[model samples]
Target: MKRDSCQQRIYAVRRVGLAIDRAARATSKIDKRQAARWATAWGVACGVRQF
Candidate 1:
């Protein structure tokens, strides 16, 4: 039981890490429109107006 729980935890962590890695890789390939949207959201969150 303990070993099974440990294995499950490791699997979950690996899945989350892989998702983060994919997101980082995808962000690097973002086009201007997506980048603009991200920038706008970030600016709004930071209380700045993004043109």
Candidate 2:
């Protein structure tokens, strides 16, 4: 597979993962936006890349 196409697939997967995380947080009675912020901060602190 081409590098560009592989990158696009990785990006799409990250977006979907983030969406699922937010949805799960919402169902748990947490504020979605706040949950997203927390997730991003945690990712950054853990040296993980964010999309």
Task: Tell me, by TM-score, which candidate is best.
Answer: 2
Measured by lDDT, the strongest candidate is 2
Q: What are the runs in model 1 whose C-alpha is more than 4 Å off?
A: 1-3, 27-51
Residues 1-51, candidate 2: write the lDDT tens digits. 555855765665566567557757595556776667666665554346555
What are the per-residue Cα lDDT tens digits for candidate 1 across 1-49? 3557556656555554554455555645555445455545544434444
Q: Kindly provide the TM-score of model 2 when superposed on the true structure, using C-alpha atoms.
A: 0.46
| Deviation from native of the Cα of residue 14 in model 2, angstroms | 0.5
Candidate 2, residue 5: CA error in Å?
0.4
Q: Report, for every candidate in turn, its global Cα lDDT versus the true structure.
A: 0.51, 0.61
In model 1, residue pairs whose N, Cα or C atoms come closer than 3 Å (at least 3 residues apart or on different chains), thus clashing, are: none
**Per-residue error at 28 for model 2, in Å?**
8.8
